[model samples]
Target: MINVDNLSYSFPQKDLYNKVSFTLEEGQHAAFIGASGNGKSTLIDIIMDPERYMFDGKLEIDPNCKIGYVSQFSQLDKTKEITVFEYIAEEFIKLQNEIANICTQMETSSDIETLLEKYQEALDAFDAIDGDDFESNINKKLNLANLNKHKDRMISELSGGEFKLIQVIKEMLNNPDLMIMDEPDVFLDFENLNSLKNLINSHKKTMLVITHNRYLLNHCFNKIIHLENMEIQEFDGRYIDYNFSLLQTKIELQELAIADDEEIARNEIRIEKLRERATYNAEASNGRALKARVKIQERLEARRIKAPFVDIKQPNINLANNNEIEETIALKVEDFSVAFDEVLLENVNFEIKSTDKVALIGINGVGKTTLLREIFKNNNDCIKINNDIEVAYLSQMQDEILNESNTILQEFYDAGFETYREIRRYLSNYGFGEDRIEQKIESLSGGEKNILQLAKVSASKANMLLLDEPTSHLDTYSQIALEKAIQNYNGAILMISHDYHFIVNCMDYVLMIEDKTIRKVSMKKFRKMIYAKHFDKDYLEIEQKKKSVETQIALALMDTDFERAKILSQELEALIKSL
Candidate 1:
């Protein structure tokens, strides 16, 4: 838990926030949403005390906490090039060193060897709790996000989406009591996004998430903190509730602004008159009159001009100009297969249309991304469409589009924007301001870079948006905002995300890609399939057996009898449940 009181932080512009007071409780999930450059990141940094930003008031963190922060990206030294296993194992080594120091302090005899063994066990136990399910957890999450099949590969070799997976995997392993995740969903596909949201739901710790992803805010967060008008305010609702309410508030603010100006004028005239009267009788003013004069001065100074709230809306992209029916296809595939030494999947087929707003859906490692790429490649004649469809790709891992040497604005410019004004306008839509546009893209977090990449694509004037897991790092509000933007987009959208809410909200059709195959289903039908899949007879039967047997085996593990351990182990061979 942490508390800030009467907090005011400043930059060269207006106060990022002023006189703000709030508390983040131990078990609450706080989501921060704002138009770009309203100081969401600055607030987070201030909370974390990263930049040593000046504070006007107080920030108090719980004394009994080791806060685990998952930054938007992994910024390891490139020279290391570690594997996932190695990366996680190193944490245990650190734990080992800590235990050694503790044992050294508690030393009593030459039996220190025994202490070493005990400390080793303790450290091992520490890692095992998180590492036990880590293999399956990472693989399941990666496959869902389309980042599997590369787990054994060096971290440096991972694509943008893949690195995002690494970042998530590392964070999940920490098991922090207080998790500060920035754009935790940036690189996940729909199933992985769903898995991520569920994982966040299961966590029993406090979370402060900064994202623009609407789907996350809608379901995962219990509180919404909107940054507007140089102050922070909390809304008790989901992302959708807060956003629409915010939109209405923006309208109301404009009316308030009009009324505020008139009030200010009247107050100024009153103060002038009061000052004139006080000036005439300065030497003989009594207590009541002096008090009245002081009160008038305070009232005149208190009426600060707060800017009316403005919605950080999306760009109005126009691509629908077709007057004739071009019953052609955009992508064709036949016997499109991909495999490792072991076959993940093979022999896929699908077609895309310029008019379709489709979602790529599948469980992790079902080859969803592979299928999308295959569809884009040429295979056979059954698929018919215009070959000239310009695709705007927003990869789940923004590293693909992000260049360290390039500033955020430079990346857009490099994407072939003709002018500076165009670049600024595009960045603004993604919540970036003029100050942020010039910041290095690589310096930006995974989520910030992602927004920039999306802005680049939108500014590129592309008609077919080939989005591969764009919801990974976005906060819940941003997710829905994007969903709304996509819904309004006339261009064809081929998006791959694992957020169920996202897929359900923005997509009109579904593309189920698994085992190197592709099948197009209606959104309604896909939902039905998901429901039936969960409540099937086979699953229900196994689930019922698990509940009854798990308790008995756990009890056996607690017993000292050799026969009981053997018998219980035989009766329930699997200790960990699949679900």
Candidate 2:
């Protein structure tokens, strides 16, 4: 439980956030969403420990509550003395001990202050480290963060995904009354993401999350607190509800302001006309009009209408080109294996063709990204790439591409643009406006960087596109914009994405990566795995005999075997199940 009033923070002259106020109730789930680096993390640091950061504000906090945080960056000291397992075990003991002490105090009926002093000592230590049920806690956390499968290994050897998984596990064991996590979903796989949702469901505590995972945000959080332009706004309900409500509020405010402006203008004109009339009739009429106008304007201005909400909608870059590869292969991988210190994929063979939109699905440590890099030779992998091919790759992390000295405009120019104005215009089409173009590349939000990367590649003449989770952390509008662009593209595409909507819309093929091997499947076949086979199949002739056989049965069951149809359906299902 906490409250903040008139909180403001500035960097020398620029105020990243100024005068933000909000409150969080005990056991409530809340989310903070805004453009990246718009003081979201800075605000979180302040909330977690105000004393640590220099700021002017009156923050009312439950002094008794111990705060636990899982940061997005997941800064860790790998060279620490203890082994990773030993460290985890010690943390678990500390948390369990703290919980035990709390119970001990309650049993002895100690005074709140004495209990507080003892509890705080244990809690501080526990919160600083990971807590009780070390094994289960780690597993649950790793599962949620999608990192637990890598636990037996040394911390130093783990990948970025592994580190992120540990951070989530640490939070689970600590069991703080309040949990603050930033970007917790970046590395989560399907199963772990579900585990996290279950944990959130079971936990009876306050949760303050900063994430861009739309499904989790919509499903888990009830309150949405969005920050932008150095301000914060509270809205009831989930992401979709918040978005709709915000849009409605904006439309209403715009209408009200327009009406008020017209009224004020009319009043001024009436007053001027009355001033020109020197006669008694003019003076009386004008005086009445002026008085009424002043009263109306004062009432309107006094009627408190909070500033209307506005959403940051990204621009749609419609990428289209002449259809080049209609019957040729786009990418082929045979006996593909890659690793730094360990092998990721082994003896993999797959070929992607024109008009075959594909998705490479895999878990966190499975090297979905590494394979992409290997395809472009960004890393080492045993594979053969076709010489006569054009390709563009979108990386999972853009931090490596960042240059501190470059501005957004300059980056575009460096990427091979003619002039400042040309790059500025191109960026504007991808959501960077005039005000944003002059901003340094380092100052741009994560979403902005992603869009910029997409634009840069979209402008290239490459007909083959290899994307690695391109839609990760992007907002709904931006995601839709990207989907539209890909749909409009005439070139071949072999993409890797987890966003269900985007994958379904843009993919005609799918490659499920499991056990370091790629099991390629036509998207049409994958759809059948989920469908119930209701009324009948499409009129087109079926290529696969298995599907055709089932279609005939569904058609035959229209009358004679309606009752026995369900039984026959089970048999058909059984046949497919064998696959």
Candidate 3:
């Protein structure tokens, strides 16, 4: 168990927390949630390394308990060459070394009995901690993450998402009493996210996860810890329940404040009347009455209710409608094949209708981002776009578009807005206040950078948007706001995201990239198919067979083999109808 009391942290510029307190009991799974830059990470840092930071707080943790941490950013040194298996088995390797050392001591020591006792003790400790089954357990988790094939691959060779999974697996292998994960869902795809959720649910340890993924928060955590407005608020249920309770509390506070204001006004009026009467009389008795009335008014003022809790204002994103264009297809890809030493995708074909909102999804290290970038390559014969359409692309790496040296105000102006009022109005829609406008871009958090890029994209007035991981670092509220904006957008959107909720809310179609092919399906049908695949093995096999046939058909069409394409088309039709 860990107890935190009166935790306060400050930087040279701002005070993040003030007298915040919370507790994490043994075996409790809790979620930490708040807007970006609200000190959620700072609180974790203080807990993990109290001496590194200067803060006033009382953190009481069980001395025997071990902590395992997975940071949002990669902590591994990419330059070092370490295989996935070696990394995950590091803890077990250390235990083995200790046991071997005990054996060596037994062979050399004069006090042979003492050495033998120590050796037995070490062996027992190893067995008690499941060290004997370490390899099997690591393999099982790696298989669950669909990374068994890459067990021998160097960590440096893996993609960011893959490496993140490895880090999570490594932490789990430690079997720590307390697991602290920060934004673990940022890099996970849908399948891996499910695996991670299942792991968290089954683990018999205390957990404190900081994430903006609503599904994970609602399903995996039994408690919610909200860090907002320099305070930490604890709730006893899931995220949805906590959110509802918070809204109700805000409403109640508002009503009480309104009543208090009215009563204070009435008291002040009565006090003024008494003062006027006393002045006219100018007598000792009247003076005494005025004093008494003044005291009563003071008491009433002292009893006035405090105002309601108001969240920081987030930006209001209002994307401009696309200009009218005659082209029905905003983008079309045919016979698209891409390779980087090995084939990532082949014979991929899809079309984005002018009014369509399409999502691109696939497993980690697949060709989702590759396919999106291929369109921008412009030299590829496979991709074609309407001549009059303007395209705006938000890459997964947000820094590609942001200028680190520029201030927020400067970046907004650079996006084509002329006046300060215009820029401020646009920034305010995204939750940026006057104080944040002058801040340098480099100092902004990841979520803030995402918002800035979104604001720029909205200002572009482009008819076609190619967004890669657009919702990655955004808070729940910001994500919902972006979804609403996308819903109202008249332009075409071809986005690559792992956020199932955002995809369902904003996208009309899904372009799933798998097995070096892209298959298009409606959002509703995709959801149903994934649900079926999860619960029924027979259904999953059928879907896999259908996908295989579809891929064959796409390949046949690309080769202009009309006869083969016709036969495969009939087979695909029959398969779908049967399902």
Candidate number of the best lDDT? 3
Taking the tens digit of each residue's C-alpha lDDT, what string does model 1 give over 1-579? Answer: 888888888765345787887788888888877655466777778777634776788888866666667666655455667875556445655666777676775576577677778777877666654644655655665565445566676665444444555665566566666778776665555445665676677667788888765556657998888777678888876664564454344444554565677776776677666667777766555445656766765775576546444433343333333332344565555555677545655666666676678898776556666655644453535433466666667765567656778877677767887788988876676677787677766555455565666666666666677788775655434555577678877667788876665687788889887555678899878777765753344443443354335334334333423355455444444422332
Q: What's the TM-score of each model vs. the native?
A: 0.65, 0.74, 0.81
Residue 437 lDDT (model 3): 88
lDDT of 3 at 186: 81
> Each model's number of backbone clashes?
36, 4, 6
- Model 2 residue runs over 4 Å out of place are 8-18, 35-39, 48-57, 62-66, 75-84, 90-150, 156-162, 228-230, 235-285, 304-307, 310-312, 318-327, 339-342, 378-388, 525-579
lDDT of each: 0.63, 0.67, 0.79
Residues 34-75 of candidate 2: C-alpha lDDT, one tens digit per residue: 765466777887887788878887788988887778766564
Between prediction 2 and prediction 3, the one with superior TM-score is 3
Query: Pairs clashing in candidate 2?
Result: 91-130, 92-131, 142-148, 143-192
Comparing 2 with 3 on lDDT, the higher-scoring candidate is 3
**Model 2, CA-based lDDT:** 0.67
lDDT of 3 by residue, 29-85 (tens): 999998887778878888888779888878888877788998876544678688889
lDDT of 2 at 307: 42
lDDT (C-alpha) at residue 414 in model 1: 76
Candidate 1, residue 20: CA error in Å? 4.3
